[model samples]
Target: MIRVLEPPRLAAHRREPLLNVPPVITVLAAAMLLIQLVRDWVDVETGIEILALFAFIPARYDPSVLADGVLPGGVAADAWTFITYAFLHGGWAHVGLNLLWMLAFGTPVARRFGVLRFLSFFAFTAAAGAGLHLVTHEGELVPMIGASAAVSGFMAAALRFMFADGGRAWRPGVAEQAVHAPAPPLMDVMRDRRVIGFVVVWFVINLAFGLGEPAGLVDGSIAWQAHMGGFLAGLLAFPLFDPIRRRPGSDSYSRTSRF
Candidate 1:
């Protein structure tokens, strides 16, 4: 009799939780759903009132507009809209897409950054997104709501560390097998074909939305400018949020990395 070798096999039941979405993602998604439920049950007038209080209105930054229809929350509410608006969404589709993206892209980031750092990164990108929108659409009364800006930020940050130097995007459950390599240098990322292609595609899609009607996909007009702001913020500010640091005289790849 001759002995034969075989490849390793996984247990049939071990396929569950393959993607490993973080608990923080669950919390964020739940919050968005709950808020939407509340908004749906409320009367039309009250719904408008809620949007007024929570959504990011570019005109809110202008004192003249706030002088008339402002909520009773005072300046704090106006200042905090940058953070609150991200939690609200215009419709079910809007919230669903944002939640799905959060689970997919945000999982790796939260896993790498931990809860506190991940939240800080989220807050920073959200505010940066709102700031950019204010710059372009100043004094506009249209309310901007949704998580696309923050989600785009996550995508940008993921691009920095989630892909190998060879420009191959990492797949789910393969982070454990990844060769311990430092994130590509910023200049290298700019030159990478994959990165450039992704950026171009994202820009074209956004430009299309900016130029024409969204065909009822989202609840209202998409804020592509805010999305760009968040993407740029994450791409440029990832170094501040990244926790991995090389110790003196030690190889950076010595420790195992996980997404």
Candidate 2:
């Protein structure tokens, strides 16, 4: 009997684990939802009270409020509001939009930065955004609430690494190809047409919303200043948190772990 050799079988293409996203993103979104539920179903007055305590309110630092002394149940300077306010939101739509943006952009940043760094990035960017809001509208009495600042930060960070080629940069194949393409320099990023275009569009949208909100053209309040602050913080500060990793092989970008 003659022995016959058989051809080796090719490995089946494993589906990319797109659904296996980072857990932190889900947790952050859940926290927002839980807070919103409490605000809606719990006591409306009590919820507002809680929001006043935790939400970022520049008036908290008013000279009169300071001279009157920080009252227990009244507005007072609370340093924690910077990070705490991000967990609170105005309404379902506000929270929903922020959560969606976070899930989209935060996942990649969290995957790249890990749990600890991601949390730190979120907190710092949020604080920075609040600071900007304070500087811009020091006399405003309204409380600034929502995760837009942190989400904006994540957006800017995503822009740094996500847009490898252009608007078509994030394609699965393109991601893999990025392993070979050197990460664009900070300056080069500004020069890239895609980046420039995205920045311009984002700036224009925020400006329109910011200006229109006061004119009563846009519904609800939009903390456009906070968004800009967060975006700038994430864009300028990403390098500090990012780990210095050598460019991976051409195929490495395709591997979900690179995310």
TM-score of 2: 0.81
Q: How much does candidate 1 score in TM-score?
A: 0.86
lDDT of 2 by residue, 154-244 (tens): 9898787778666454764344233233455578688778899989999998888776664322225788899999999999997777653
Estimated TM-score for each candidate: 0.86, 0.81
Off by over 4 Å in 2: 1-17, 65-77, 166-168, 176-182, 214-219, 245-259
Of the candidates shown, which would achieve the greatest lDDT relative to the real structure? 1
Across 49-151, the per-residue lDDT of candidate 1 in tens digits comes to: 8778878887777877667546645677788888788988877877888888888778777777777778888888888888898898888888888888888
lDDT, each prediction: 0.74, 0.72
